[model samples]
Target chain A: GAGVSQTPSNKVTEKGKYVELRCDPISGHTALYWYRQSLGQGPEFLIYFQGTGAADDSGLPNDRFFAVRPEGSVSTLKIQRTERGDSAVYLCASSDGQRETQYFGPGTRLLVL
Target chain B: AQSVTQLDSHVSVSEGTPVLLRCNYSSSYSPSLFWYVQHPNKGLQLLLKYTSAATLVKGINGFEAEFKKSETSFHLTKPSAHMSDAAEYFCVVSLRSNDYKLSFGAGTTVTVRA
Candidate 1:
C-alpha cells in the first residue's frame, strides 16, 4: 500500500560536485519516470524506465544527468559537476505501465550553490 | 511537439462558489489528458484523467472535466469551491506514439476564501 518514495527529501550541494538521488517505486510497479521542476514552472521529463532498462532518456539535459534502474524496482538519478542552474526539485513517479496513471513521490529538492 | 497550456495563472473564489480552470493542448495524434493537484509540501495527486473513452471525466473531490476535441480544450470544473481546494493544478497531456511521456502546463494556482 506504500506509494513511491524518494530519499533525502532535500539535498544541498556545491557546484562541480556529484550527487545521487534515489527513488523507490511502488511495489509491483513496472514503469518509472524522473522529472525536474524549476521554480514557477511545470515538471519536465528527464528519463523513463520500463523495467531494468531505460526506455527513454532523451529528456536528460546533458551527459551530466544520468539514471539507472539496475534491478527494475529502484532507480537512481546521478548528476556530475552540478551547477547552480541545476537547482530545482527532482520528481519521481511510477505506474503499472506506460499507459497507466502515474503516481508521484514527494520529490527531492536539490539546491546547488 | 505536444504541449499543454493552462489559461489562468491564478484563480480566486469564495467558498461554495463554482470553480473553473481552463486548459488547452496541442498534439499530432490522439492524446491522454489528465489533471493533477499538488498541495503545499505534498506529492502530485491525480484528480482525473481522460483517455479518449469518454468526453466528460469525473474525478475525486467533486471535480470533473470535459474533453473538447473541437476546441482542443480540457477544462476542469467544480460546482463549489472549498478551502481545501487551494493548491496548484496542472494540465497534462501524453501521447501514445511518444511512449506516454507527460507534457505538463505551467499550472494554475487556486485560492479559496470563506
Candidate 2:
C-alpha cells in the first residue's frame, strides 16, 4: 500500500513568485488535506478536498492560496505571489473518508527568499 | 472549537526508563484524539488514536495512551524508552461535526538518552 506522496521535496523561489505543490494520495482515498508548518511550530491546516470538490477551505490563510483535486485522487496546492512569510514545510495528507487516521506525505519544503 | 495542547515542550528519558508525554484537549463535544510522531526530515506517523472505542489505546513501538475524560487528557506513555523513539510527537484532536478537520498541538520533542 502506497502512502501519500508529495513532489518537489524541496523548493526555493523568490518572493512574488508562484509555486505549485503536488500530492498523490493513496489509490482509493477520497479525502485530501493540505497544511503548512513553520519553524518551531506545528502544522497549520490549509485546505481539504472530498472527492473532486473542496469540502473545506476555511483553513486557507488567504485568497492567494488555492488547492484543487480533480478526478478525486491527485491534488495540487497553488500559491500566488508568494511572500517571504510563506516559506514553510507544506504537508499533504489523505484519509479513507471514514474520518479515520490521516496518512501524511514527506512534505514539500518551500523557501521563499 | 476544538484544540489540543502538549503540556511539555520537550521530554527526555534514558533508555529502559519510562516515558510520558502529557496532552490536554478541549472540545464542545466528544472528540477523536490522536498522537503522531515525526522524525527529522520524515513524514508524520500515526502513533495511536482514540475513537471512542477504548479508553486505553495501544500503538506501535510499544506506545500507549489512556484517555481520561474527567481530566480532558490523553497522555502518551511507554514502559521503556528506546533511542529510536526520539522525535517530535504531536497531539491532535478532531471533531465529528467539523468534518474531522484536525487541530494539532505545538508538539513535544522527545529525546531518548542512552
Candidate 3:
C-alpha cells in the first residue's frame, strides 16, 4: 500500500515570501493532519481535516498559516509572510477515519532565510 | 487537557540487552495511547497502539508496550535491543473521540551500543 507523501522534500524561501507545501494522503483515507517539528523538539499539531473541511485548526499559529484539502484526497499548507522561525520540518499524516492510527509522510523541510 | 511525559530524554543500552522507555500520560478521559519511532531524517512510524481493547500490545521489530491504567503509564520494551533500534521514540496520547488531535511527548532517544 502507498503511504502518505509530501512534495518539495526541501524548500528554501526568503522571509516575507509565500510558500505552499503539498501532501498526498493514502488512498481511501478521509482524515489528514499537519504538524511542525522544530529542532530538538517533538512535533506540534497544526491542523486537521476530515473529508473536505477542517475539523480543527486551533493549533495553527496565526493567520499567516493556512491549509486546505479541497477534494479531500490532497492538501496544501500555505504560509504567508514566512518568518525565520518557521524554519522547520512540516509533516503530514493521514488516517482512515477520525480517531484511527495516523500514517505520516516523510515531511517537507522548510528553510526561511 | 491531555499531555504525555517521557521520563527519560535519552536511554543507552547495549545490543542484546533489554530496553525500556518510560512514558506517563495525563488525560481527563480514557485515552488512546501510541508509540512512534523516528529514525534520523525520517518520518514518524507507528510502532503500536492501545485502544482500551488490550493492555499488552505487540508491535513490529520485536517491540512491545504495556499500558498500565493504575499508573497512567505506557512503557515500551524490547527483549533484546538491536543496533538498528537506535532512534528517537515518542509517546502520544489522543482523546477517544472524533477529534484528530494528538498530544506528543518530548521523545526519548535510544542509543543502542554495539
Candidate 4:
C-alpha cells in the first residue's frame, strides 16, 4: 500500500558537480518515469522505463542526464556537470504499465549554486 | 504532437461557490486527458481521467470534468468549492500513440476564499 517514494527530499550542490536522485516505485509497478518542474511551470518529461530497460529517453535534455533501473524496481537519476538551469524539482512516477494511470512521488528539490 | 493549455493562471472562489478551471488541448490522435492536483511540498494526486470511453468523468473530492471534442476542451468543475481545494491544478494530455509520455499545461493556481 506504499506510494512512490523519492530520497533526498532536498539537495543543494555547486555548479559543475554531480548528483544522483533516487526513486522507489510502488510494489508491483513495472513502468517508471522521471520529470522536471521549473518554477511557475508544468512538469517536463525526462525519461521513462518499462521494466529494467528504458522505453523512452527522448526527453533527456542532454548527455549530462541519465537514469538507470538496473533491477527493475528502484531507479536512480544521475546528473553530470550540473548547471544552474538544472535547478528544479525532479519528480518520479510509476504505473502498472504503459497505459495505466501513473502515481507520483514527492519530488527531490535540487538547487545548484 | 500533443499539447495542453490551462486558460486561467489562477482562479479564486468563495467557499460553497461553483468552481471552474478551463483547459484546451491539441493532439494528433485520440488523447487521454487528466487532471492532477498538487499541494505545496507534496506529490501530485490524480483527480480523474478521460480515456475516450466517456465524455463526462467524475473524480475524487467532488471534482469532475467533461471532455468536449467539438471545442477541444476538458474543463474541470466542482459544484461547490472548499477551502481545502486551494492548490495548483495541472491539465495533462497524452496521445494513444505516445501513451508513455505526458504533456502538461502551465498549471492553474486555485485559491479558495472563506
Best by TM-score: 4
With candidate 1 superimposed using the best TM-score fit, by how many Å does residue B110's alpha carbon deviate from the native? 0.5
Clash totals, every prediction: 0, 0, 0, 0
Candidate 4: tens digits of C-alpha lDDT, residues B1-114: 999999999999999999999999999889999999999989999999999898999999999999999999999999999999999999999988898899999999999999
lDDT, ranked from best to worst: 4, 1, 3, 2
Clashing pairs in 1: none
Error of 4 at A112 (Å): 0.3
Which runs of model 2 end up more than 4 angstroms from their true locations? none
DockQ, all models: 0.82, 0.74, 0.76, 0.91
Candidate 3: tens digits of C-alpha lDDT, residues B1-114? 899999999999999999999999999998999999999877799999999987999999999999999999999999999999999999999888734788889999999999
Q: Once model 1 is optimally superposed onto the true structure by TM-score, how far is the C-alpha of residue A55 displaced, in angstroms? A: 0.4
Which docking class does model 4 fall in?
high
What's the lDDT for residue B20 in model 4? 99
Runs of candidate 4 with Cα error greater than 4 angstroms are none
Residue-level lDDT of model 3, residues A1-113, one tens digit each, is 98899999999999999999999999999999999998877899999999999989999999999999999899999999999999999999999998778999999999999
Q: What is the lDDT of residue A57 in candidate 2?
A: 92
**Model 4 Cα lDDT, one tens digit per residue, A1-113:** 99999999999999999999999999989999999999999999999999999999999999999999999999999999999999999999999999999999999999999
Whole-model lDDT per candidate = 0.95, 0.93, 0.94, 0.97
Lowest summed lDDT across 10 adjacent residues in model 3 chain A is found at: A35-44
Question: Per-residue lDDT for B21-63 in model 1, tens only?
Answer: 9999999999989999999988899999998898999999999
